[model samples]
Target: MILSTTPTLEGKPIQQYMGIVTAETIIGANVIKDIFAGLRDFFGGRSGTYERVLQEAKDYAMQELMEKARLAGANAVVGVDLDFETIGANGSMLMVIASGTAVRI
Candidate 1:
């Protein structure tokens, strides 16, 4: 399914609005990853471990978002919004949420 951040898809007219679809995912930080990330932070460099985990979380959230749209009988999702948040003490978990209007275009 086509997912776009814009309200309208280029050259594609929306035929119907199937209501809003939303999904969220929360991934906990792994101990090994946190250890490596802490070392990287102390050394003042990027943390690949954290970055990879966040990326995976985002992908999973988007996948869920698309599944919601499909279940709503939408061929596409428009005006998509993605949000990120850190949860738990010391930001031990990452939350990714996706929302959009499910549509047939």
Candidate 2:
């Protein structure tokens, strides 16, 4: 499936609007990793663990959104939006959301 933040695809015209499709994922942070991240924060460097976790969450959410579009018989999604939220103490929880208009080309 093709997913984009733009309103229209490059070559094909959107044939049908299959309503809105959205997918979200909530993840709990690893305490062990958090401890290391705290230390890394003091050193003022990148946190590989945090990056990997967020990336995984985004991928999972996007995949789920794509699956929803597929179920709706859409070949693509347009005006895609990505959102992130951090919840709980020590940023222990993360939420990733993907939203778009499902369409058939």
TM-score per prediction, in order, is: 0.96, 0.96
RMSD of each: 0.8, 0.9
lDDT of 1 by residue, 15-98 (tens): 999999999999999789999998999999899889999999999999999999999999999999999999998889999999
Pairs clashing within candidate 1: none
Per-residue lDDT for 7-95 in model 2, tens only? 99998998899989999999888889888899999999999999999999999999999999999999999999999999888668999
Model 1, residue 92: C-alpha shift (Å): 0.5
Alpha-carbon error at 56 in model 2, in Å?
Answer: 0.4
- List per-prediction Cα lDDT, in the order shown: 0.95, 0.95
Candidate number with greatest lDDT: 1
lDDT of 2 at 70: 99
Weakest lDDT window of 10 consecutive positions for candidate 2: 86-95
